[model samples]
Target: MNRLRAVVTEIEGEQNLHIITFDCAGSSLKMMGLDLPKGLHLNSHVILGIKPSHVAIAKHLSGELSYSNQLQATIASIENGKLLSNILLHVKESDVQSFITLSSSKRMNLQVGEQVTLLIKASELFVLEVLDA
Candidate 1:
């Protein structure tokens, strides 16, 4: 699991389902969820969590994409396995990791220091923990 410390910036939508936005590493992150935990309000500090497998990489991405979170980052390092590839990315002051297939990594020709876009869906995000402001 990937974890990020963030603060809730905004919240929208009806009961049971909401579009929650957060300020993380100077970037705005959005998450779609069925329910907001009790006492979770705007400005509340929380821990954002996502699975490495859920992260998608895009090269020279253009136009509109359905994914709510698109982070601009650079490949920091890569650990290629027999079937899976572990990618480390540097985004602002944070390091994000992604697990992708070796074939996809080769198809993209990803290299260290190469610019790439990280795509993450709102639904893939989860509130790992809420911290005191």
Candidate 2:
């Protein structure tokens, strides 16, 4: 899992559903969920988690997208296997890992130091832990 330290900036929802926003190294990220743990409130410090396989990479992306989290990052390193590829990305001050198919990696022609956009769905992000206030 890729973990990022963030602070809760906003929370909006009704009933059990919620849309939580966070400030991660100056980048805004969002998480959607139905259940929130105790102590998760505005200005709360948190550690966000997401699986590497869930991260999507976009190169020269244009037009609009529905994904709530789109982080601009630079490719730090890439390790390709026969079937899968592990890509390390530098986003702001954080480093995020992305797992994609070898075919996709080649098709995108991703290289070290290249610029790419990381796409993450809101529902895929979760509060891995709530930091002490």
lDDT of each residue in 1-133, candidate 2, tens digit only: 9999999999999999999999999999999999886789899999999999999999999999999999999999999999999999999989999999999999999999999999999999999999964
Q: How far is candidate 2 from the true structure (C-alpha RMSD, Å)?
A: 0.8
- Largest TM-score belongs to which candidate? 2
Query: How many clashes does the backbone of model 1 have?
Result: 0
- TM-score of candidate 1 to 2 decimals: 0.95
Superposition error at 87 for model 2 (Å): 0.3
lDDT of 1 by residue, 39-125 (tens): 789999998998999999999899999898999999999999999999999888778899999999999999999999999999999
How many Å off is the CA of 122 in candidate 2?
0.1
Q: Assess each prediction's global lDDT (C-alpha) against the native.
A: 0.93, 0.96
Candidate 2 versus the native: TM-score? 0.98
Quote the lDDT for 68 in model 2.
Answer: 95
